[model samples]
Target: MTIAPAASTSALSFDPADPVALTQALVRCPSVTPEEGGALALLATALAAEGYEVHRPVFSEPDTPNVENLYARIGSEGPVLIIAGHTDVVPVGDAAAWTREPFAGTIENGILYGRGACDMKGGLAAMAAAAIRYRRANPDAPGSIAFLVTGDEEGPAVNGTVKLLEWAHRRGERFDHCILGEPTNPATMSDMIKIGRRGSLTGRLTVQGTQGHVGYPHLADNPIRGMVRLLAALDATPLDTGTAHFDPSNLEVTTLDVGNPATNVIPAQAKAVFNIRFNDVWTPETLAAEIERRLREAAGNTVRYEIGFQPTNAVAFLTEPGPFVAMVADAVAAETGKRPALSTTGGTSDARFIKSYCPVVEYGVVGKTMHQIDESVAVADVLALERITHRLLASYFAAQHNA
Candidate 1:
């Protein structure tokens, strides 16, 4: 797919100091998951205008959609600080239910409305605006400032940050510290900062049995009976109580399928799918083994079953509190007058992949409206986030210079 520039009428002038305007410009692009929708193109134009060497690389997997990503850098020296986020928003379900145009970037009573108003086009705009203002103020900053924006964040994530990071690494690009602008706050903008994320493991369990009449007492085996027992056994045990920096591990059964429509027929097969969000207490390998052991105990020697795990990229990770984390917390407090809590209480994010490269953390606007109808963000909060991000950059660079 061709990456087109934002249409002239919809394309507002690029101003990195005005995050609200930048967000509006971004919201105007209906860049739903896997579709460029002119969002990255618009960002590239804006970054290039700010003297950033911008690169838009389109990555493709065999069956997944081709994704467009942006990697723009300003400077070539030490202590590189990378700010990362995604432009793609989830699909707007039931468009007719929206109070206004989902892509109009409409501002009504100091609120901006759109599909990605909060989950995270607003945050992306905030980071961009802050970085531009910082660089403009201090032209010869000590280190490089780069953006790792991607389009596949809300999708399968195959052709986005993961690949972008690898691509950048191959090109010898390195960063000292990184910030992900995912909507981390639960209520207010200063409520929290995510230091880590729980790992996700999805398992599909299938039990096979002979098909026969339901009324027959000894003619057939009911796989549903075994499946229920197996699911119960999986759910009955707790993975972990709770770690100091992480939450208690939890397993939830997402789906159960028998596919038998007739009430009088015993189904030939039964399947159950469960997803476990675990803490740092267990690795993916150990967790999978524990689950299998439980299933075996539950099945006994009678039921024939097989279990398979879905291929996942998410793994539990933590960015131990250190100088970089303290600097970020100080920045948030300085801007918002509230000391943000260092937490690891959210779902997996791109940070899982980034932690292997460098220290990373997440902070952004409140997440209450993400993926909801009439999704919107307060205009003031967007500006505040920009200020917070600017403060973070300022403090980060100063600390780097002093060191």
Candidate 2:
């Protein structure tokens, strides 16, 4: 359930230096997807010391083990503002390729480096620092300010934001607006603001055939041949022309495999994996049906196949040019002297779920090094992001007060 304000939410302010330290502090924790790694506890303790009410809930499901999450709020009133992001980082694929130890949270030449440094930990620290600064500046500010953070955002995502929102809703917590600190800036922090995202769907097709000697072509059906035909059919056409708010839909064949090594034998099965990032022009149902149709036509009773699609259901969604969008644009323009493009391109994020509850927009540090080996955020950029976030909250809250 959502956490409420404590007996007495204390007025707290942190050193601007604390945010950089917090970024390193969080990167030091190995909270790789669904693992707490003391990240949540550290945040909870820090927030609690600032006199905010903190709740760390463990959410679970049938097969997935429980994951720890943190929800903290500094007020129990209206005009509620929420800053949300995930703490978990993806696995450090090849640790040996790193310039420094992945989780060491090392800082050199004014650059802080680590796994979570940019993916979100750095952005998270910036938000927390901004919040602390806002609280200190406006101790009696109207409306409550809260943070909804989860551990499962970087993993399967089944028990993450989707579940956390449900938990918070059950407690009757309504958020006026939310800022998801995803690494939205593309190049120089002037590139983009992800106002929405296209839908993503992944499917794996397994074509079945009778195994036989390579010379016995007439005696047995070859699934590899069928698989190739099916892939060709799907890859033959572009999904659609680019939409006004989204880019053109595209389908890519990620993998194709046949488990066979012999030169004279035909494999019993051939499988291929493909994914689609569709625009609003098509729904999952329509796109999925189209794929099935293409596969059936290509196979034409030559080989039997089983198709399994894993639906991420990140349907294309956009927040119209409203107050939230305008304010963020204004913040970027004011801070960086560049008005970012309101984009709906790129991969899915927790904002997809947050959009269901409130108007959400993603704004944060430059993402150039997010998932890289030596993921790092520039020291100046971190401070600049802190300022942008601070200004966003100030402007948003001010707008609410004036309204």
Candidate 3:
């Protein structure tokens, strides 16, 4: 990372380490997926002005839109702790239904409302504020703290963290451990800590049948019958009872469609798409093979069917309870006065990609209205998250001093 000149304070209205103010500024930006909307540049400028070396790398793919990501650090030393998050937010459906302006970053009474307030612009801002405070206090901390912010998480996930991590690695940036600032809490800032996430696999099951008049008895083979039978087979048994750290792998049918408009005519084709959130019990290959086995047994060489799975990057992973995890847990417990559950029960996140590089866990604010009409976060929760993050950082670098 090159040392860029400090930006003027004119762009930043609030204190550099104020999480609540920073989150409001971030939420005001309409950074819908794949759009910069000035979120990264705003944060980069703020971080650079605080004496951190910042680098913004824009990535591109054949079909996906270009994306910009930021990597910044204030210290150069051992045992780097990377804080990762995305600035892009999902599109707000029915924007008119929002109580406040979707991009205004409105603060009503005590709650801040905006599109990305909870599902995780707030988390990113909390960590940023905490890191800034830590650097100001310990200018030459023994261990380094780095921020990895991306703009393509809510998009196709291409040209984002996956590529950013690779680019950083190629440039000689190594991470010792990572704390992803995803919204892990269910109702409060200290509700939960996501230690791991399940894998995701989606497949489409299609059955071919001859189109004919519905009045005809034996003229056509109804694919709907075969589709129902195949679906039944897939759901007949559980993939696994439950893993020690993970819940039972679940498969749910998302869509059953024939695209047929006329009720009097039998559709020529029937298809059902389903998704599986699996545990460590199986890999994508194994899961697909198992589905095939079940479908084959039910088909008996009579049903004409084909099953195809979509490409996936999410895979089950866990960071076993250890010194590093304990450090984070201790920080949250001490700050919140509640012992947070070390859970792996939610949908997958970018941690699936980061886990390959280093041990990674996710902890952040409550996300009740994530991607909803009035997405919001409590002002006090953001402040608490900042404090917890600062405590964790202090503990992490103190260990290095002891070493």
Q: Pick the candidate with the highest TM-score.
A: 3
TM-score of 1: 0.96
Off by over 4 Å in 2: 1-17
RMSD of each: 2.3, 2.8, 2.0
- Go through the candidates in order and give each one's C-alpha lDDT: 0.90, 0.84, 0.90
lDDT of 2 at 284: 86
lDDT of 2 by residue, 238-295 (tens): 8789877888999988888997999899888999998899888888888899899888
Residue 331 error for model 1, in Å?
1.0
Task: Give per-model TM-scores.
Answer: 0.96, 0.93, 0.97
TM-score winner, 1 or 2: 1
Off by over 4 Å in 1: 1-14
lDDT of 1 by residue, 1-403 (tens): 3333332333346565799999999999989999989899888888887788888888888999999998889999988999999999999999999999999999999999999999999999998999989999999889899999999999999989999999899889998899999999998988999999999999999999889998994899899888988888988978889888998999999999999989999999999888999999998999999999999998899889999999888899999999889988998898889999999986888998889888899998889999999999989889999999999998888888888
Residues 335-393, model 3: lDDT tens digits: 99987889998888899999999999899999788989999999998999999999999
lDDT of 2 at 395: 91
Candidate 1 clashes between residue pairs 3 or more apart in a chain or in different chains? none
